[model samples]
Every structure is written in structure tokens, then in C-alpha cells.
Target: MNHKVVSLFAGAGGLDLGFQMAGGYDLLWANDNDPDAVSTYKANLGNHAVLGDIREISSEEIPECDVVLGGFPCQGFSLANTGRRADDARNVLYLEMLRVVASKRPKAFVAENVKGLMLMSKGEVLRRIVADFEELGYDVQWKILNAADYGVPQRRERVFIVGTRHDLEVDFEFPTPTHGRKPDSGKLPWVSVGHALGGLPDPDSRHDLTNHTYSKYKLRFNGYMGHRAIDPELPAPTVTGRGDNKGGVVVLHHPSNERRMSVRELALVQSFPLNFEFACNQSAAYRLIGNAVAPSVGRSVAQSLQQALKTAKVAVKGD
Candidate 1:
């Protein structure tokens, strides 16, 4: 069958690339608010993403599609924000998705966000979101996924809420973890940071020196902002979407070097191809990378969705 996807919150095309690479979806349209992200998306994924705020774009303008993809703004629901509330403006952004889904009525939809969303208001926020989607006639399900378990050399945990139109026979099962420290699950050991960054030479070669460049002043406030050096022996912690290459940002320091991890190295850890450029300054590059859905994790979900679609069709035919 065909999988035509219309994506919202399409930042730098991470999730979009994953779905396209997973090989069922033909991306019909995509949207995002950031100019740089839209530029990067066009550069890396071709010209599909529209540059504008989702709130302003009416649902009628969105093309019809089988799946709707969103990586909604997570700050309002993130643990980093202690002042979050049920009425937080950002918390309601998913309603924009609801608007589009209600208007387009896609067969399936998927939304990704920081894991903190599950704990917001002791989970009331999540319950409400699920209820709203259910009211849309979707069979809703969600799970917290750790990227390390899905082949990315990062342990970033995220929540994915997937919905199938109520009438479909297939249920969306979150993909099982394929990597862990213990042996009982028949899974491979988690990919270490070394697995991704071990091949680079000392950060002086032009390629290394240029791409692996760091903020000289960042070391001035060393150890501030909870910044720590990365450990190559294990998967990295969650990669945040903001970094100044200078101090006053969140980034893991290079395991071997004193400087912060460069945009390329960060992209590698996020499972993005080496050739995939961020097309922005160092800080913007760091910010976009930090904010993106890890492509490896996105691919895992896309693959499962594809399977569910196939199974649902077979069931319908048999009946």
C-alpha cells in the first residue's frame, strides 16, 4: 500500500527522513516555523517543508495524507520548565495537530515529544491528549522510548503517541527494545558512544578542527550548567536542541578533547548521516540537532507502522 504523509513541526526533517527511509511514505507536504530549520530541511530533504507557524496555517491548506507527523514543541511539557501549567500556551500546540487531523482525517498519526510530557501534571495532560484523539475516532496508544534501544548511540528517552483510525483492525505496537545491558532479552549490547565517534582523529585535522571546533570561552565556566564530558564506553545522554558552542548552553564535552562535541559529532550520535549538514551557524546547528527526533528511533516507529498497515489490510481482505 501507499503511505502518503503530511508532516507538521517538521524540524530539520529528522522524523521526515526516518519515515522516508523506512520506505513506505511519500512525503506530500511538511511545515515548520523556524527559518533555519526550513532551510536545513530543504537542503537535506529537498523542498517540501513550508516555512511558517502551524497556528496560522489553516487545516484547509494542508494536503490530504495517510499519516500526520508532528514533533510538537516540548519545552512547555519538559521537566526543565518548573513553571509549566495546564494552561501553558505551548502545551496546547498539539491541538493544532488535532485541528489538522480532524480536517484531514488521516488513517494514522504519530506525535513525538520529550518524555516529561508523560509526567506533566501527574499525567493529566497526557490523559487529556489521549482523550481528545479518542474523540477523533482514533485508537490511541503511546509509549516512552529510549533511543539507545533502537540503534542510536544515545540514551535519549522520548514519548511517542500513535493513533490508528478507529475502524482499522491493526493495533500500533511500539517497537521492542533491541539493545540493552542484560542478556536475557536476546538483544545486542547497546551501541556505545565510541561506536559513533571512535573513528574521528584528534580534533586538529582541518576536517576535525573545522567540524569539531569548540567555543574557547565555554571552558571558562567549566563544569557549570551540568555540562559533563561524554563517555565513549556507553550511549550518550539525551542531546538537547540548544547549544551556543560557547558557554550558557547544554552539550556533552568531547570525551577525549576539552572542547564541546561539534555539530557533526552530535549528528552522528543522533544517527544522522555525516553528509547531512545543518546549514546554519554553530549555535543554530546545535539548537536544531538538540531539538530533533533521533532518526534511528523515528525509523523504528515508522517500520512498525508500516507493518501494522500491512496487517490491517490483510485482515480487512480476509473479512
Candidate 2:
């Protein structure tokens, strides 16, 4: 039987998809606020996607599940942008997950956020998040994981927290690094911009504003050629809401080509399935993609969780 999971703040179902790939979990419910994200999630995840803001949804309204997945808003806790003062409302949303955990009491959960969360508010914020989860009766294990370490092309780093209900009492372990070993890195292969966007329309030629294009990688020899490469070896760079617009630094098409990465390419780099279509408009697509958790990472954690559950089940049977 597939393990059941309820996902919150589920953007584009990336986390859910990863867990599914790991071979045991079936998403019982998924939540997201953006219409575009919701649409994409629904299309990809089917009936599980709850198209609305998570805060407005009641815990009782959700179905039962073995695990809960969430990647809450990070603006207030993110170090990349300024204005994360003591009073940002977004920072407090972590409490929302706490509230849901108290009510739903899933067997386990995996929460993700920007790596800066580790040092936010000089670490006080992270401390609070841990304490809050513990208070809700969970044993939490967290680590800074880079997409690069996991074989993604991007160099994005994130903080992942895995927690089990106090009753479970099972210590969670992060996945071992898959890349960077001797043979793999004997000559460390860096998946550069060329690998990410090698042949696409010119970023300038493509006027699709809905895509939210971010920064494109510059070609070393031909700065004017707008070509981006796809490095399959390293973890992919962080997929952001602005990947389509070339707003943030991104792997662009050949400089002369002008087209930024299409939404499908972004999803692929983020480890989404090729057939998995983003259900929203271009801008909405960026938002969902940017906020999504890499499925590969999620699948790794899910595999670990599934093993723990099986071990628990076996112990109970023996007893």
C-alpha cells in the first residue's frame, strides 16, 4: 500500500512528486493559494490540490495521512532580501504548520526553506521553529542541502527539517550526499550556463511576460549569444518565480537567441516530470516553480521515512 501524505503550501506538487517517485506515498491532499500554482498542481496532482490559501483552510477539512509536507513562505525568514525585521507577518506563518500538526498529528513531515533560515535573526528564528515543532510533539532533524550535492544542475541551497511525532520517537537522518565522491568529482564537472540553456529562443525575442523570466547565464566566448546549457550532473539552481523573465540571474538562451528558459525546462531542471505541465499562466508558473521543493530531495527524505515506518511496523509485529 502506498503511504498517505498531506501536503501544505504545496507549490506545483514538486515535493509530492518526489515522494511519489520514492515509491510509497500517495498525496491525499495538497494546498496552494495562487490560482496558477493551484491549477498546475491540480492538473499534475489531480483532485488532491486544494486551490486556496492554506491559512484559510481548516485542519478538520483535510483528510488523514501518514505524512505532512510543507515549505512555508520564506520572505520573512529569508536572508537574501532585506526588510525581514522582527515583525514580519510572514515569518510567523510557521505557527500555522504547528497548528496543523497539533490537529492532524501526522506520522512525519518534511519542511523546507531558504538556507539563510539557519541564521535568520542571528539564529533565533530557527530556534523558535525547532522549539515550536518539538512542543507539538515532534522530533526534528534538519540540515542544509544543496541541489548541487544531489545531482541537480543548479547550485541552490536550502534548509530541510524532517520531524516525526514524539510517539514515533524515530531519529531521522538526512540523505547521504550522492555527488562529490571521488569518481564523480575526480574532475568535478560543473554544469554551467551552457548546459542549462543551449538552444532556445532569444530572451529578448520572447515577450511572454507571464513566464516571469529571470537572469540568464552569459556565454563566456559569445556574450551576445543567448544560449543556456543543462548540466545533468549537479543539483539544479534554485528555481524561482522569476525564471521566465530573466529578472534574477538565470541560464538564458544564446545571448543572440534572447529566449529565456521555457516553463517546461524550468520544471525539468527542478526535477519535475517532462509531462507534468504547469497549470497556470506564465507569471503564475514562475511563482509555483520558484516556490517548489525539488522532488529528488523530497523523494530522498520520503524513502528514509518509509524505511523508518517499515521498521516500526516490523517491530510492532514482532512484539
Candidate 3:
């Protein structure tokens, strides 16, 4: 963790953690509007997070750093919500990133979003994002990457955009997947949902695991784990913030205890280490986890950026 980084829209420090795991970057600052998210960021990052909306912060006030990382809000571009039209006000948040990058002039940046961004507003929205960075004098490269590809068991796919100042003479490539593409052993293959929470207690053993469920849904999906230990062999189900209130997906409980998965367990699924102390309560933890980039995926992206920067530095020295 030698490289310095500033994180914006840093929900639960997922992207930041990933960079750390990749073994080169030190987080200098982080920002998020959600109090719970900010709490989680500060708790885990230990004084690195700024804890506010991006629009509220002045770039000059931020510390200088080598890389900027964030997963900007995508409500305006999500295909899940049909109302996300071209004119949706939220779509412009990319400008906030452009604003920060233009002001901070970091060596590089990594911005991620839902895969739906590709088709949003018939692709005009994505195009505009690319154009905006280019307008800011950056050479941008983008691709849609999957979480499962990077070693996490989740099937999450996101669009990753990397930008560098045009004169840097750097072209970045996305990291190649390390897990799903190759079998870990000749027989067992990569890790699975069963592997991730293998020895944990069972949800059936605890009352806390069922407290948040609707009685009818609870009875219907009885074996489903909500906030419980999950099957590790499969990539994790998408982690959501609403687990305390509603049943969005199957969350497997530990085999020995009936309670849902703990915050620490959730973090592991997201690829955070055992010691990562998330701020806030269960609900807040869920939100942060939901919004974070998987550390494994971040590491892959970081490797690409590191190489790109090295190449850029060499070209400059040669010149």
C-alpha cells in the first residue's frame, strides 16, 4: 500500500479496500453522503474518510493523491428503473468526478458503475461520461468487468472506466480474471458459497435470523439464508442494505446458528479482510457492502493502472 488514493462516493470503502489488498495504495481521503456509509468508511479507514456529499466538498480542500477511485451513483442510468431517462438529473454526477479530477489532477482514476450503464439512454449517457473525461484532457479506456471473474463468487458485473491525462502517454488494460477462468484444483475448482461460510452456525439455530422476515415469505423460503452464512462455491448473492427489513435474495445462515450473517462475514464475501471494522449498525453495514467494489476486482484494476503508470513514467524519462 505505497500509492496514495482519494475515494469519492466511497460506500463502505469497498473500492479502497480492494486497492489495499492489491498491495500498493494508501487511502488519503474518502467521501460519501450517507451517514451510515460515512460511519462505516471512517471506522474501517480510520480517519481517512471525508464523510460528505461530493458536491459539498471543494477539490482544493482535498489532499493531493496519485489515484482517485469511486463508484458514482447510477440511479439515473440504471435500466432497472424505467424512469431513468436521458434528462434524469442524477446522470450528471459524472461531472462531479470530472470536477474532482480536473481540480486534483491525480495520476489516474477508476470509476465503476452498473453494467446497465452501457445501454442507458440508448448509450448516450455512457458516451457523455466518456466525452466529459476527454474534455477534461484525459485519455479514457472503459470495459464491463464481472466480480466473479476476479475471484469473488458473486456474479456482479460493472463498467470500469480508467482515465489518465492525455499527455501521460499511458494506456491501461483491465486485469485478467484469476478464479473462474481457471480451476483452482483439478476437482474442487474455485471457492464456493459453501466454502465461504463453511463452518458458520446455522440460521435455524437462532431467532435473530428470522426477525426481519415477513411471516409468509419466511415460511415459504424457510431454508433460504437471510444475513446468514452462504454457499461460498457460488459467487455471493448481491449484498443489499434492505436485509434487515425485507427479503431481497437468499442469504444463507451458518450451519450451526440460525442468525443471519454478521457484518464481518458480509465483509469477507465482499473480499474485505477479517479485521476491517465497519462503522454503523447492521443496516448501515448492508448499504456499505452493497455499494462497495469487491476488493479482488479492485486489485485487478489496480494492477492494470500500476502498469500503465509505470509505462507512462518510462516514456517521460526516455523523452
Candidate 4:
């Protein structure tokens, strides 16, 4: 059965693409305020994505679907944001997601945010969010997932909150790790930057690779974010959307420690496909890639959801 999906804050279609890759998912509708993101989603994925603020577009505009997926704006809850505030306005964007879910009442909904969200407000914030979802007549559960554990070549961690309608009578199970620090009986070692970027040509000597351009910001090894040398042998540090004072997006240095990784390279580290093009300028492309959910990690979660829904259907038929 093909499950319909409606996505919000669909930046460059990373999460939506993951669901599409998982099979049995049809992206019926999507929305994002960024013009570049909507353009990219249309160019690569489909033209179903609408361009507008979620707040302005009412739930009535969205079609009914089996699932609601959102990676809601997380700048306020990110640990890398030194200027973050407890009452940061952007933190409430998830409410917009909740409003739609409340209206549409899909079989299940998935929300993603930075790992720092689990610690926000001394954990009170997360508790309250979970409580609110439970009040909507659903079984809500959340966990922190590391992308590298799922074959992404970056050590990015994000919290995923999943809710299933109580009537479904199925508990959602998060996917197990397929890659790790040490190879286990059934798992492979975490993918390294060297392994991920092996065949890409140097940015200076490009050979028709799209969006293969790097930032010229000089490297600084001050131990701060995006300032340290990368270990090619290991997974890359988290890619962030912050940038230098001159307005250039701060991208991680290449494994060779010579220059910053290009937009395409960073996208690769985030597990985006080679042909997935970002329909924007270089700096905007960096922000889009950094803010995206790694497609591989998203696929794992999607697959798990697919399994849970299938089990629920079987149980209903058995009854």
C-alpha cells in the first residue's frame, strides 16, 4: 500500500526524498517559505511543494495523508547558537506543525529537531511537548539518533519524536544502528569522510560536478565550530548553518585541511544523492545542506514507520 505523506518546513526535500526512497510513500503535498528550497524541491523531487509560511497556509490547504513529517526550524534549540534564548520565537514553529497534525489527524506524525532540544529548559520543554502530543490521543515516543550509526558520513545527532494514533494499536520502533564505532556481528564500521568523498574531483579542478564550489574563508584552528582540522579517517563533525562575520557560510575544512568542502561535498557528507541539486547560490546552498536531515538517517526512520504501519494494518484485519 502506498502511504500518502505531507511535509512541512521541507528544506530542499531531504526528508521527503528519504521517504520516497523507502518505497510505499507518495509525497502528496509539501510546504516551505524559502524560494530556493521550494525551487530545489520542484526541480529534483516534484512540483507538489507549495512555497509559503506554514502559519499563513491553513491546514485546509493541505491534503489528507497517512503521515505528517516535519524537521521544524531548530536554530533556537541548537547548542551551536551561543545567543540562543529560552523564549526564542523560532522554537515555537513546531506548534505550527502540531496545529496541522491536530487538524488532519494523520495515522502517525514525525518531528525532528536538534539534539540540544532534549536539554532545553532543563528538559521541561521536551516533557511538555511530549505531553501535548499525548493529549492529542496518540502514543508519543522520542529518541536521539546519530546519523553516523545509520551510514551517513557525519556524526550528526538529532531528536526524533514519533506519535501514532492510539487506535492504531501499534508501537513505533526506532530503527537499529547498521554502522557503528566498532563493527559488530551484523553492523559495519561508520563511514569515513575519505570513503564518502573518494571519487570527487578537487574543487579547483572540477569535472562537471554540480554545485562543486567551496568557501574561500581562511581556516582557523581555534577549537570552535568549523575551525578545526577534519580527520579523514573518521566521520566528519556536525555541519552547521552558522557563518563568518563577512557573511560567508562556515563550512568544514576539507579532509586534506587545505580548503572548505564544496556545497556538493557537504551534501554528500549529509547523505544527499550525487545528482540532488541545490537551486540556490553557494552560501544559501550551505545553509540548506547544513539544516537538512541526512537522507540516509531519514530513510531508516521512514522504514521503521512503514513497518509499524504495516503491522497495524495486519492487526486490524486479524480483528
Model 4, position 3, has a per-residue lDDT of: 84
Tens-digit lDDT string for candidate 1 (1-319): 6688999999988999899889978888999999989999998888878999999998888888889999989988987667877788999999999999998878889999998898888999999999999999999999999999887998888999999888776777999888885634588888888778888765556562333554443543344442766677888878886444443367666666467677788888899887787877777777788889988888999999998887664333212
Q: What residue runs in model 2 are displaced by over 4 Å at the alpha carbon?
A: 181-237, 242-259, 313-319
Model 4 misplaced stretches (Cα beyond 4 Å): 244-249, 313-319
Task: Score candidate 2 by TM-score against the native.
Answer: 0.80
Relative to the true structure, how large is the alpha-carbon lDDT of every model?
0.82, 0.68, 0.70, 0.89
Higher-ranked by lDDT: 1 or 3:
1
Candidate 4, backbone clash total: 0
lDDT of 4: 0.89
Model 4 Cα lDDT, one tens digit per residue, 1-319: 6888999999998899899999989999999999989988898889999999999997889998889999999999998887877799998898898898898888889899999898888998789889888888889999999999999999999999999988888768999999999989999999999889988998899389899998898888887788888999999999887775332546998899888899999999999999999888888888888889889988999999999987674333212
Tens-place lDDT per residue, model 3, 6-124, is 88888877888778767777788888888877776776666777767788888888888778887898766664556777777777777898888888777888999887789986788
The C-alpha RMSD of each candidate to the native structure, in angstroms, is 2.9, 5.4, 4.9, 2.2
Count backbone overlaps in model 2.
59
For every model shown, what is its TM-score relative to the native structure? 0.92, 0.80, 0.82, 0.96
What is the TM-score of candidate 1? 0.92
RMSD of 3: 4.9
Q: What ranges in model 1 sit over 4 Å off?
A: 208-212, 220-226, 242-248, 313-319
After TM-score superposition, the amount by which residue 137's alpha carbon in candidate 3 deviates from its true location, in angstroms, is 1.7
